[model samples]
Target: MASFKTVMKSGHPPTLFAAFLYFDFCFAIWVLNGAMGPFITETYKLTPAQTGFMISLPILAGAIMRFPLGILAQYIGRKNAAITEMSVIILAMIYGFFFVSSYNDVLAMGVLLGIAGASFGVALSLGSGWFPPEHKGLAMGIAGAGNSGTVLAVLFAPPLAQAYGWQAVYGFAGAVMVIPLIVMIILAKEPPDSEHQSFKEHISCLFTKDGWAFSLIYVITFGGFIGLSNFLPTFFYEQFAVTKVEAGRLTMLAAFMGSGIRIVGGYFADRIGGIAVLSVVLLAAIGSFLALTSTPSLAVTTILFMLCFAALGAGNGALFQLVPLRYPTNTAVSGSMIGEIGALGGAILPNVMGFSKQYTGAFATGFVVYAVFAAVVLGCLFLWQKKWVGAWVGPRGKVIDPTPAQLQAAGRLEPIAA
Candidate 1:
């Protein structure tokens, strides 16, 4: 194992830091509505279903926008793409501050927030691009830990909303956006890892079975993380009758666990293998989900959520550790495609939970359904890895040079070579 200092020496650390800050701030903005959900619901007199839809709009829009931004980043450069997106996000925040007067306008603001959410692929790719393959997991994990921006949103937004009104928080968010934008301009550089590819090659991952397989797993990992992170404040407020600020605080505890553990996940994935780590985390997520169906006490529920989030975060890191191995040249584009699909699953989760509570009188049904879906994906992972192991990766999803026997088994070696 390499020392942290050694790993830092291996990559462009300033660019990595810039990417982390960029992603962190963008993530805080992306889930701003979720952090302020109780206030928004009160202002609009929203039904459970309406609250779900309102919270989900940004996620859906962001997912749809990610791939396009990734393609643009390929042409214009990731650094430039990030700068452009943040510029738009700041303007959108200004719009939210002055113009969002009614439910319809709030919905429009949600779409605007999607612009912030589109930062995922470019941020991870840019941060890890300078590192060698062995260390990419840790690099990506550090960059990916920017999802901790959820903690910032949940921790600060509610109090700010309470003090100055929910809409005014947008202005505050826009003000803070300047900090990251400045850092990105001064510190980040376009990574040298990129290759100029034609449009068809850039889009090729979209057509592969492995790409879709990765998307399905991410649906459980990142999808679950973003979805539940957005919904948790609302869940605590309504389910346990906690105050809105308290709800946000409790959600912070869970989000914090998820964000912090991501780095650990990536580090271990680099050593033991991403597949091994992913398998453990997935089972842990499944167990946590199943346990949540019983509707325990407030403390118990928070702890369960924290455990679930930790598993999801670790799964996220573990999965991405394998992504570069699978799609070395097209990391940004392939990541965006996977992220796009995975985030669509995020859009689905809140609506499911909301409707479950409204029509069926319990959130347990939603938990059960998601757990089942995760189980199925786990089965698929086991099935898919059999082909993956000797083909492109070693056992447990480590990068490897295929042995002659392995190459022959994969039918890649010529007769003489075999």
Candidate 2:
């Protein structure tokens, strides 16, 4: 394994820092509505189902926007696309501060928040693009760890909302957006990894079995991460009768674990294998989900959530370790497509939890359903790895050099194999 300093030397660290900061701020903005869910619910006297839908709208919109932004990044460059998206987010936040007076207006603001969500694929691709194959996982892990932005939203948004009203939180978010925007303009550079290709060539991942497979897995990893992160404050506040601010603080404990563990997951995936790390984390998630269905005491529930989030965060890192291996040339596009589909699962989760509580008087059914879905995806991963192991990747999804026969057959050495 390479030392951290060696890995830093292997890639453009300034751009990596810029990507992490860009993504960190974007992710915070993306979940801003969810962070203020309790306050919004009180302001509007919203029902559980309505609260769920309100939180999910941004995620759904973000998912729909991801692939298009990725495609645009391919043409305009990822750094440029990020700057453009951040500019839009600033405008959206301004609108939220001034115009979001009604529930309907808040819903509209949720859609605007989707602009921030579009940052994910481009951030990961740009950060890792300058790194060699062996170090891409760590590079991406560092960048993706920007999901810690969830911590920023959950920890700070509630108190800000409490002090200045939830609407004022939007103005604060917009003000902070400028910090990342400036850093991006000054420190980031377009990586030299992309190949100029036709639109169809760039989007070819859409037609592949492996692409959809990765998407399904992400539905569990990232989907669950975002869904639960957004909803946990609401859950703690309502379920445990904690004050809204305390709910946010408690939720922060769990989210902080998920965000920090992501880097470790990627580093270990590089040493062990992404497939193996993912398998273990899936089981951890499933078990945690099952335990949570019992709806234990507040302390126990918080601990279970922490464990569940850690698994989801690590799974996120492990899965991306394989993404570049599978689609080396067009990672930005493929990642966007996968992220778009997977985020739909994030949309599904809060709705399911809300409706379950509304209809059944408990959130247990939601946990059970997600646990079953994860188990099925885990099975599919096992089956898929058999074909993936040698066709494009090595044992357990490690990077490997192409065989001489494969090199000759393709008339060039493929980047899929190291």
Candidate 3:
């Protein structure tokens, strides 16, 4: 509460509020196909693999677009970059609403929707740059809370599709986009002192160890959260013989846990440290995924899924909290690259679930695979903590403010080219 007050005290409330709305509505469109999976699948007679690939296209497309969007945010400014991104989404929704008549048409729409997903770096930077470092975790968490848009999609899209046809969902999405567009025009502004690093320097981050590490972690955390959210409707529908609307209702509960509680995750990351919070989160995820391996009853599966989403949601907050601290001078670039890389999880995980089902007649193998991978990452993060402890203010318990020479010596700083 105090941190939030401190954040609001130092930043523009209108800009932050606009950033949240921009992210919220865009996110709803970003995952729309997943929410409408049953309708789309039934309409196209899509196989499990095709359905997985179709839902994953937007994620893959977003990943491909994010690096450029990240750089664009640096050059054009986050606000302008956001405007461009939203416009694409609106137009794509319009096309989906009126003209999408074939499977290929739907795939094209997914590519355009990737622009909305690419908004992550720009949207976060738009709000996060307005605040001081100490308040960054909570500020970003509050902004990132926009992920809750998943709940709205799952809750509304299925019923809307049932009543008005799945394609009508796009028209509604386009209409909603108008709300954020107007608000962004009225309120979104670049922070006065926000850094704008060179594109070459931003790209150079991809070669660094920290860059790769963050991306890998996000792959598991965000990938698991979003991938699972996207896949859950399908999982429930296929496994339990639930109606599309019923599956959506179930998926909404889990998505809500992941998206809504993320702010609390950031609060703890600010207090006890991001790495600390992530440590607990990853461990919990490992346990939950492992539990899912045993073919639990629907009741137990729901509990396990909720726990996994909770951990991933909180882990998302904690991870981003560490981002600015680790690469303070390159927040947008690092965030963009890390976000882009981590998003591969969204692209990859669903396919894994699909293939697992394709061959094994069950999704347990995918759960086990994720659990094993997360365990390996947990160990890596454990070692990373000791090395980064003296470098971060929140994690180290005091601001060390190490000199450039010291930072370089610790291998925690990269030389930016002029």
Candidate 4:
């Protein structure tokens, strides 16, 4: 593994920093409604189910948009793709502030905010492309840590909404987005040799067994991470009877812890192995989810949720670390595919919790289901390691080249050299 200075020398720092800022602000805006969920419910007099859908629309819309944005990043450039996303956010903010009046109006704004959510692939492409292979995990993790922007939303949005109404939150987000937009325009650039690929090339990379496997694994890690991030505010409000601002403050702490730990996760992935890190995190998540099912006190629930999020953050870094190693030549497309599929979990989990609460009068059923799923995913990961240890694992435990036979068995026609 590279030292911090060595890793720093491997990529253009200004661009990487800009990528982090871009992703940070995008994420803050993407889940703004989640932070404002309690307030929105009060204002709109929405049912639990309605509140769930409100938080979900942006997540689902973002998932839907990520694939195309990934493709677009290749065609235009990651920087350009990000610029376009920011432009949409500005427009969306204007609409949200001036035109939105009803629940449906807020729902429509969520769809537009989905463009901000779509920046996941673009930011990853921008930050990871500039870094050396051995350091990509750390690079991507730092960039992905922009997810800590959720802290900004949850910590501040509710207070602002309380002071000025939910519409004010959008205006504030728009203002905050401007700083990153400017920095990105000035500092971010496409890495050299990032030539566009044909649709067929992308398809060949995306439509494979390994591709789907990565997607499923990402769904659990990133999906669970983001799903819980968006829903925690609602969970806190309903389960604890906290005011919106207090709920935001608690969720803010959890989001900050989770997002910051991702960098450590990435660094460890470079040193140990992505699969190794992922194994530990999935196991931790399974335990945490199971704990949640017990419906412990607020303090216990908060601690358990924080522990779960910390593991998810680490798993996210570890998962992307494997991507460049397994599909070096197709990282952009494969990352996009995995990211898009994984992100759909964000939309799905909130609905699960909401419906569970509505019908079961509690959230234990949803927690149990997620825990079972995490355990199943962990089992599959262990089996995968057993199957491809030689080809995919280096003698020193880093990613290495796979043999032709190994490539074929993994559903790839060619092996990407390490």
Q: Is candidate 2 or candidate 3 better by TM-score?
A: 2
Score candidate 2 by lDDT.
Answer: 0.92
lDDT of 2 at 105: 98
Model 4: ten consecutive residues of lowest lDDT: 408-417
Off by over 4 Å in 4: 392-397, 401-418
- What's the residue-level lDDT of 282 in candidate 2? 98
The backbone clash count of each candidate, in order, is 0, 0, 0, 0
In angstroms, give how far residue 96 of model 3 lies from its true place: 0.7
Question: Could you give candidate 1's per-residue lDDT for residues 1-418 as a string of tens digits?
Answer: 6999999999999999999999999999999999999999999899999999999999999999999999999999999999999999999999999999999999999999999999999999999999998999999999999999999999999999999999999999999999999999999999998888889778777877788889999999999999999999999999999999999999999999999999888988888889999999999999999999999999999999999999999988988898887777788998899999999999999999999999998899999999999999998899989978867787898768655565333312222212
lDDT for each residue of candidate 3 in 92-209, tens digit (9 for 90 to 100): 8998999988899888988977888887777777778878766788778888888888898999999999999999999999998989999999987787745455556666667667
Each candidate's TM vs. the true structure?
Answer: 0.96, 0.97, 0.94, 0.94
Q: State the displacement of the C-alpha of residue 116, model 3, in Å, after optimal TM-score superposition.
A: 0.9
lDDT tens readout by residue for model 2, 222-318? 9999999899899999899999999999989999989998998899888898999999999999999999998899999999999999999999999
Candidates arranged by lDDT, highest first: 1, 2, 4, 3
Looking at model 3, the pairs that clash are: none
lDDT of 3 at 155: 96
Task: Give every collision pair in model 4.
Answer: none
Q: In order, what lDDT does every prediction score?
A: 0.92, 0.92, 0.83, 0.84
